[model samples]
Target: MKRMIVRMTLPLLIVCLAFSSFSASARAASEEKYWDHWIERHAQPLDASNASNKDLRFLKKVLKGKRIVQLGETTHGAGEINATKVRMIKYLHEELGYDVLAFESGFPDTNASYLNMDQLTPKSTMKNSIYAVWHTEDVVELFDYMKEQKEKGDPLILTGFDIQSMKNSFNVAATQWVKAVDPEKAELLSQSENDFSTLVTDSNTFDEFSQKKEKLVKNYQKLIKFTKTHASELKENLPKEPKAYEMFMHSLQLRIDVMETYMLEEMKEKLEEYPENIEDFSFFMRDRMMAEQFQWVADTLYPKKKIIVWGHNYHLRKQNTKMIKDWVQLNGPNMGDYLPERLKKQTYTIGIYAYSGASLDSSDNKTVKPVTSPPPSGSLEALLKAADRPAVFVDFLHTKNKKGTSWMYTPRTALYWGYMEEQMILKEQYDGVIWLEHITPSVIIK
Candidate 1:
């Protein structure tokens, strides 16, 4: 009788605790939603005074001196009404005394050998892989202003990845030319190899801008026509020496492809050196880009200078710190873990994120859901590790909501049914990161 009573009471006690915890989490989420409502409810522009003294104090702490402050937004802003962005910048420069202005459109760390972010120019106003031409307005506006400052002698130490066509061993200069006797005959395709060289060498000497543009068009046309003629003759002779002919053509076409068109690049050849699978590819690239960026910043930019960096919130997401994990554990003279001897621990990385995105909820990508009060700041695996009082709740509540599955119920039905793998990819390395979520996406799924 005594054993039976103890067994039954223990389960009842567990059910009660779970019920209370769920209720607390739900209430905390509701409070977050309410505060967010108050923050954005105002239509007034974000001004210096609109921010609190605490805001500036925090800014000062985060961005004092040559610290790198990276603000990652998925896309550029629109129109003149980007109040939030404008205010954010103002707080950094004015309150924090930040001297350098950096951009995520390019590299944020002061690494000269850093690989520049690729700038894709769309053929039209639409979007594509290589060029996000339409979204380029923000980059153009920001860089144009910076370039103007450089020209005025109030220069900034501007650094980022350049988006020039790497395929071109020679760029616009290869196609642009100097003047000939007249427009039509002068612009004619040059069959003379020396003429092509001369044109590219002295293209700047061409007075009229139109003259330079016309030369480029003619240069490509000439090459294309010449290739077509040669390829036809080779085809007729191909039955006897097809392999040799094909090899010759391949070499020739490659030249034109690089210096002329925006065709498929050498990603395949590069990929060939790595695992072909997507999981392997993503992890490999993530590590490679992260390492390359780190080496470029620390070694190339400043051997003995203090710096700051802003990157994707993902880089600093404490719970899901996948990007920097391998790098942190990396032990070497030039690894993320290895601080330079000259620098005695002034280096730090801070992550900032708005806890807003189409995350756990299946709704609009930009939809804002409530931020549940954080679970008692315990690792998800802690319950498995410590089994004194609380029973593990991995599958205890999966059937409570179809859209939002709690880790309680549905898990036991299937082996390894949790999103543990995806979640682990998110939590890895960081100093301290802030979680914020905006509540003003066009739709809210209550």
Candidate 2:
């Protein structure tokens, strides 16, 4: 009887100890499940301080046989993430043979142009010409990295609609569209086109937009020539004169002309309105171009490769995979929904975050802020405003101040609160998502 009792007690004690340990771990890991710190900190690598050694080890450990890594936003906000990224990239290319870096910040056509060595020569009207020449921060970093990779005889692939221009193409497209909807308005649209065209022609500064890259210059010239040829065909087919928005197959040519022309200026203009010209630009990129173009290039370029696009979170959404997902379940094109079940989790991942601890509003910080996701049906803006106890309006309507100090820009504060009450105003999707893992010296730690 004594021996049996001792055995029973020993078993009970072991069970109790196991339970206690699990409870502690559960408590600790609850944050990883709840808060997005680990993912967020990934924007900068933990091995940053000793990047050369750390990055090499990291690549070997994590990305040994990656086929695609569409994005890696290692800007780390304000601190210097470039050098660290360069080191990691060198490791990726030199050691692991991850050779390509695909950029979605440009149009596929532009990719062909860049490859062809097009001379930019931007028009005074099209603003993207400037950024294209000067290049945005990310663009510049990518260019530098690409150049270095090439010096090492490595391959690089670039893709995407050139920023605001994609969003801005809708304006020009709308002109053609509107004319189709209303026959009577053909003459009016023609007048608008004549006016816009005359302005473009008169602007000698049009050539001021230089095609810095040879491939881009060649592409531009090709597009210009294509536009002129297409314009003549559209004129020939139209009744009297082509109405601005005629729904004919030939109108695609007109659409392309409008896109390339506006591409020249979308970023140059101040476009804060909903029905603005910029919207026209965006529509052209989203609605007309084949998303397959980018996907095909990515598939070929990667081929058992691991890459990091460094694009906005929206592009990564594997959930609502395609622009057409809202309409079709299994049909049409949407990468977000089509990822294999295993890859789905990583592929369609996204990180919803609050980027604190930095002066996030600088023009240089353009890559970080604006929260990638748009205000969902005005809910984000609405909820943010309503929850703001001391809500401040800047110019009243269109934009509300975040809170505390309205000097140059309003700072975002506790508005992330609404997500708690299940009253979260908006729920945006993410693809290949993770949050910042650690607070860097450049940003403040909340």
Candidate 3:
């Protein structure tokens, strides 16, 4: 009787195991079917030119009533991503009425270049104002496009929202503004200008910068206080350029705030407080300042105009990941994360990624680094690559909570220069994603 009972139990256990295996296989097939259908239903093919911009018509519905649209790249060195962004910028400008194109570049230099865009060629304007990392052939094409539109009487105003003075252009531009506004006060700014130029261009490390931090802070404070004290007179002096005056004053204040924040980070280290990783304070402050600059653009400068923002995915992502939280415990919010609730509601962000490609190394922008391996199996890039499209844009807003695509809600990694990091909830991080099956390094403009 015991032997018979044992035999029966063993057979039943085998049957249960077989059924479980069948169920797992069936679930995987269903998921695959869902993803295939979803891609076919929603993926928009990316066109490189505005001539066939009908492919981008879907954006009209997705971005309806949006005031600010942010286009972000995984890295700064992808040629295809830059080309695709230019096409989107054209559509946003012509079809959607986004007239302002703000970059992740120097606030002072970019505005000065825009003010004198008529006198300068596109290449010169880009070279003098924007960061060298973005000095690519594809971006040059954008400057050319902006020039063409200005000629056609549909001007796309160029500006930037960064606090860091990337070049000496800022020093020249800022000093000129002060001289034009108040000649007597111009010398006060000149001192600060020289100090800042040295801080940005000469100091290569925090250690080097620390030695000059006190003097730089003192000079910047004096200049900022002087500017505030004579604000009304300065505005009156620039009667014909009230908006420019306001922006100039605000840029000066922001620069000082950035300097003070760096000083605070150094102080924290000296005090032996939050000693785990004090650099996070400076990183957080930079993004916070960037968000403030963007807000000033959206609310103060271009209140009625639609704006387009171009920047890195790391800076523009609205959501924070476990990695970021762990890494930046003191203050980890990104530029997008710092945006006010009202502006966030009216904003749409798109993150661009690639499954496989080579990119210019971020360290030097000259070294070519080939993608040594395919995207991880569960990454967002891998999922998109499985769709087998050369390039496609997937709208995360509409696809959430759908059948067979629950993977959208789950944590997954995304490719960054052919590498993966800790998983993040992709749907939360971006409103949409543009995936390139393959990419090449940006052609750096010499």
Top candidate, metric lDDT: 3
Please report, in order, the local distance difference test score of every candidate based on alpha carbons. Answer: 0.32, 0.35, 0.76
- If candidate 3 were superposed on the true structure by all CA atoms, what would the RMSD be? 7.6
lDDT of 2 by residue, 126-175 (tens): 22211232233433454555544544656443334332233222233333
The global Cα lDDT (0 to 1) of model 2 is: 0.35
Give per-residue CA lDDT, model 3, range 1-446, as digits (tens).
99999998999999999998677546655576577677766688876644878889999999988988999988788898888898899889989999999999978878877766666788987887788888888888888888788778888988898877764676666666678767666776666666766564465566676667667667667767777887776666542433667667776776677666754564554554453543366667677788888988999988998999999887887765333322234325778778899999889999998888888876788998775357777677878866677889988877756555756766566765666454566777888999988889988887
* RMSD per model, one decimal: 18.6, 18.5, 7.6
Q: Say which candidate scores most in TM-score.
A: 3
**Candidate 1's TM-score:** 0.37
Give lDDT for model 1. 0.32
Worst 10-residue lDDT window, candidate 3: 322-331
| C-alpha RMSD of candidate 2 | 18.5
Candidate order by lDDT, decreasing, is 3, 2, 1
Candidate 2 lDDT at 338 equals 35
